[model samples]
Target: MIRLEGITKSFAGKEGAVAALDGIDLTIARGEIFGIIGSSGAGKSTLVRLINLLERPDGGEVFVGGERVTDARGQRLRALRRSIGMVFQHFNLLSARTVAGNVAYPLELTGAYGRNEIAVRVAALLDRVGLSEHARKYPRQLSGGQKQRVGIARALACEPAVLLCDEATSALDPQTTGAVLDLLRQINRDLGVTVALITHEMDVIRRACDRVAVLDRGRVVEEGPVTRVFLHPRHAATLRLVREAEPDGGSLDAAAASDLGGRAVRLTFTGPAAHKPILGRIARENLVDYAILAGRVGHIRETPYAQFIVSLSGRDVAGAIAGLRASGVDVELQGVAPVPEIEERACHVV
Candidate 1:
C-alpha cells in the first residue's frame, strides 16, 4: 500500500517555481490497480516519480506499507526502492543483453544471490513473463510488445511488492496495448503486487484501474472508482478525457433537437439497470414518443453501462423524467429543449 499526504513538488521554471504536484493526498490500497491520468504537462509522471522518491516532494510525507520514507537515504532508500519496481513507456532494456541477462541484471546488482541462484531466478522470471523461448534473443530481435515483456521481467527480478507503470502501453498499437494490459492484470492477480499506473489514455484506466485520480495543472481535480468517474465524469478535464477515449459517438444536433418537439435528455444507466426494459415501460406508461439521438452501451470494467441522448415528446415530460430517475436512471435535460424546471442534482442529471 502507498499513501501520499499533502504532497507538493515544484521545480524552477522560466516564470519562477512551477508546481508539478500541489497538495496531493492519495491512498492506494494493497493489491489494487490505481491509475493517475492527465494530459501532457499535467504532472502525472512527476507524481509517480515522487512515490519512489525519484523526485522527493518539496513538502509532505511519502508512506509505503505504513512507513514514512520521505527522508530515507543511503541503504534505507535503496532498500525501499528495491521493494518497488518500475516499467517505463519505452522498454528500458539493455540492447546488448539477452532476455535472460536483462532479467538477471537487477538480481546481480543486489549481490544477494550467487551465480546458480541468479540463473535459476532469471529463468523462473522469464518463464513467468512468457519470455522463456526468447531468453537467448537480444532486444533488437524482439517486437515492441516482446521488448516490453522483457522490461516487465526485469522489473520483477527483485520481486517488488509494488509495480509502478509509467505510460506502460502508450507506445504500442491498440492490439499490443491490450496484450500488455492483460499481462499486467494477470501479474496483479497472480502476484498480488500493488500497481500504480500513469497514462493519458482513458481506455487504459477503464481497462486496468480499480480507482483513478484525474490530474490537471498539478492538481488532482477528481478521484473515484473508475465506473463512477467514467460513467459520470464531474470535472471538465475528466469529461474531456472521456470524450477523447470514445470520440466515435456523435453529439446531439440542433436540427434533431428541433424536430423532436419536446425535451432532449441524456440518460445514463449502469449495472442491472443497463439491461432492464425501463425505457419501454416509460414509453407505454407516459405515452411519450422518444427518438434516440445517440447512445452507447459498454462495460466499465465488469459492470455493464448504457448512455443515451434521447429526444422525448410527451404531455408528461416531467413525469417521464421523474419516472426514469425513480428507476435508477440518470436523466439530464439537454439545453436544446425547453422543459419544466427541476431541482439541480449532481452530474447535472435530475
Candidate 2:
C-alpha cells in the first residue's frame, strides 16, 4: 500500500552534495512483509525514512494507499504520519514512563481519544504485544526483547495501516530476533498491517519478508520474491549478500579448485525439482561423474531449494548440463578446472 516513484534524496557533505537515494521506484503491497536489504551506507535507512517523509526526497513522489503525500504539510503530514507506525532498531521507549504509559503516549499526542479510551487502547495494545504483565515496569526494568515489544505496542497505539521497521531486530539475539519476527508475521496476518522493513541481515528477510529489494550505493540492484532472489541471486551485490548469509555454500577457493579435474558448475534446483535425484539420474544417463565442491539444501521461506557446486568429468559434461537445463534446473558453468587425476576426498561424491 506504499509506492515510491523515482524518489531521490541528497544531503550536504564535505564533497558537496552526496546522494543518499537515487531514482528509487518501489511498491509494497497491502498486508505484505516487504524487506529492503543492503550493506551499511547503501541508503537503506534513508529509503525507509523517506517512506514516512522523515527524510524528504529531493525528487519524485511518495504515495500511500494511492494518495500522493510527497508535499504533505501541517495537519495533513501529521495525519499521514499517524497512519504509519515506526519501530526502531534500538527500542525508543521513554525511560521515565511505564510500559503502559509508553504505549499511551501516542494516543495522548493524537488528542483524538479521551483518558478512558486511551487507557483502554493502551491496555489492548499491551495485551496484543504480550506485555500486559509488564505494564507498570519502566524501560530499565525490561529486557531487550520486552523493550522492543513496548516499542511495537506504542507504534500500534494509533492503529496504523502500515508499519515501518528500521532494523527492528538487529539489536536482539538470534532467539529474540526469531520471536520478534514471528510476532511481526502474526501482526501482518492477523491485523492486516502492511510492513516495510529494512535490514542488512538476509536471514531476517528470508524469515519475514514475502518480497525483497536489494539496494547498493543508493540504487536498487535487485528486487523480487524472497525465494527467487535468495536461491538464484543474479546481481553482484545480491550474490555478495547471499554468500555472507550462507557462508557454507560459498564458492571454492584456489586450492579446492585445483583438486577437481574438470569443468566446475553450479546447479540450482527449486520446487519439485529440488526433491528429485536429478544429479544422480543425469550422471547415470550421460555417463558422467562429479565431485561436489560445495552444496546446501534448505528452504527459502517455504520453498525448498538446493544449490551445488560440482566438478564434472568423465566425458559428457555438456550433455549432463543440457539435461539439467531441460529438467528445469539452473546451471552455471564456472569454468574448467585443471586436467589431472581427481582427488579422492570426503566431499560429496556423485
What is the C-alpha local distance difference test score of each model? 0.86, 0.86
Off by over 4 Å in 2: 247-249, 254-259, 336-350
- Write the residue-wise lDDT of candidate 2 on 316-341 in tens digits: 98999999999999998775432111
Residue 298 C-alpha lDDT in model 1: 73
Worst 10 residues of 2 by lDDT: 337-346
Q: Which ten residues in a row have the lowest lDDT in candidate 1?
A: 341-350
Model 2 RMSD in Å is: 4.1
Clashes of 2: 0
CA lDDT for candidate 2: 0.86
* Cα-lDDT of candidate 1: 0.86
Candidate 2 Cα deviation (angstroms), residue 271: 2.8
Please provide, for model 1 over 144-166, each residue's C-alpha lDDT reduced to its tens digit, 9 standing for 90 to 100: 99988889988888999999999
Error of 2 at 52 (Å): 1.0
